[model samples]
Target chain A: MDQSRRFTQVPGKYFLIMKIKLELFGASRDLSNKDFLELNLKNKSSIKDLREKIINYVDQKFKGNENLRKIIETSAFCSEDNNIISENYQIDKDQKIGIIPPIGGG
Target chain B: MLHTKIVDLSKEKIKPENAEEFIASSKFGASIVFYGTVRENNENKKVTGITYDSHDDLVIKSFKEIYNEADQKLNIKEKSVYIEHVKGYVGLGEISIIIAVACPHRSEAYDLSRYIIEEIKKRSPIWKKEHYENKESEWLKGNPIQAN
Candidate 1:
């Protein structure tokens, strides 16, 4: 709803761990019932890392819903700016990820 | 320069006929309108309704790209195309999308109409969700095409 929530800061042992916010859309929103999530990932984390966290978040929240897991795996990742990003892409500060699940428009 | 009647889901209903009316001209002899309707069932399951969402900005951009692509591929001179998609809830037998293409010849109109719809499905950022009577919902099985 807010499009994205502000990042949360976590105090880490060596340094303050910054949060990487993820925006949800379509199936990702329905399955997780969350519009945004703040991951304790450091800057420069791979897009694949973000993917894993989304998958894991679905797992934890939805339990044994394999259908939802598949959706996340097959979804296309995009930056907050709406540019498509590959799984190998890196996460950067101020960059918010959006999970666009398989589309079904007629 | 492109034409679209795209409107968010609301009390206002989508009229596929609008595509034809908007593109109608004395010079063009043929106009084809394609309407995509919401069906009552999917995979033998009774689907009560459907909904759609998209990255708003990219959806508009995608439409522009699609319009340009169609114009180039068709070598469209006097011909023109129109697209309209309704987001949010849509009931059975309602139009989800409307595509219209006008050309001097009927054959070209048909092909352009088909091509526009096909490309929109494959290339647009719009996504659909199906709701079954049994309280189950699935995001339909197609990836949102990413434009490079």
Candidate 2:
């Protein structure tokens, strides 16, 4: 977990930006070709924001992979404690979050 | 005793007997063992092997959760369980997972075993990539994790 600071414009004021590390798995890893991704997000960003950021990142980097984007949309985020975090859950500190895609195991 | 492991093929392999031995108990009359294996073909494709990928820590955690759920839901008593899933390449006819359960009676033993496996499939953070004889591999589509 690491944090970096930046300034991003909000509706009336500027918000602090923080760096969050996302540990990718399965199809997300295959598409991104990276085990992890460092994303800059607004301080105290929600999981929804992270989802949007990831989808946006893929939309730009992969250019035309609709399926990959769809996978990210349905995927869920897991906390360091191995519990799935709700979309409304806010992130206020640095954490290594895991991106879990659809699972097929016995 | 509850035994759970994510067997890494490079270092070790899953043994069904080990699961059986762990769950064997004199207090239980019925013991059910389930072994999931890789087949030779799928959807008319010639399959060679399968590579299993998993979030190691989450997987073990999920297994414990499933076991606890099974114990309470099924009202199992004097029960013992053993669960092991593979984490690497498994060729055709090789064991990919093992689930063993021992309960006071046959009915609960069956129920507990089924519940554990089904829950694991839905809750565990694991994926399977199938390798075909055509030298092609594809990740099998699975149910997405529920994000509340």
Candidate 3:
């Protein structure tokens, strides 16, 4: 049940045009009301860049949902299983990252 | 060198007894079993049921990662440890998660079991939606929602 939807953003410095899918779950999904969103960004975008872009992206689309904005603010990024991401972590155009939303697991 | 006996995300009821049986052995004198269940009340509101969700593939991956780390970090790497969580609807008083650990000595087993559950909480990708008896549901985790 996966289909790609491209989100258009202004071209950044690294204009290599990479397509990365966002996999969301937990509180993130509950608040955002989305299962997934695709990011088509500069080729070698950092995790920090993606985070800001998500904020800007969501702000544009979900301006009314403050909770989801807060969730995006607190969410963590992972390229694969349990990869604790740092702000400096770079995402290749081919990489897919999962967003772990704000709520803690019990 | 604690070998992981089980790391699962099952949609069935979590049976603590099964975990007890898995850790039952003469070689291990100490064992610890912990169960997390759906209680009937939260903050004085009736919690009818809970629906647990997971990033299925990531949940197992995270569990294996935690299991492997526990096996090495605690020096009980070769001991027996099992962890499981339910993936679907679980009613009140029903078990949702279980952890069983055993070692030749009592202390290590207790310590390891404690470590596993805490890690699972901090690292696992599991999420639970609280369903109130009045039909209010929430996924925000911890904050109780008022039923209309």
Cα lDDT of model 3 by residue, B1-148, tens digit:
3323223335244567778888788887888888888889877888998777776666667667777786679877557767777776788887777777888888887888788788777766677778997899887453211111
lDDT of 1 by residue, B50-145 (tens): 988776666676788777776688777667778888888988888888887788999888887887887778867788889999888877788644
Which of candidates 1 and 2 is the stronger one according to lDDT?
2
Each candidate's number of clashing pairs is: 1, 0, 5
Worst 10 contiguous positions by lDDT, candidate 3 chain A: A1-10
Give per-residue CA lDDT, model 3, range A6-70, as digits (tens). 33345553245667788877766653456777777776788788888888877787773787677
Ranking by DockQ: 2, 1, 3
Q: Best candidate per TM-score, number?
A: 2
DockQ for every prediction shown: 0.48, 0.73, 0.28
Candidate 3 stretches with Cα past 4 Å from truth are A1-14, A31-34, B1-13, B56-58, B61-78, B141-148
Best by DockQ: 2
lDDT of 3 at A62: 77
Which ranges of candidate 1 are over 4 A from the true structure? A1-18, B144-148
For residues A1-106, write the lDDT of model 1, one tens digit per residue: 2323433345643323346777777777765356777776655778788878777887898894798888878888777676878777876565567777777676
- When candidate 2 is compared with the true two-chain complex, its DockQ is 0.73
Residue A92, candidate 1: C-alpha displacement in angstroms: 1.8
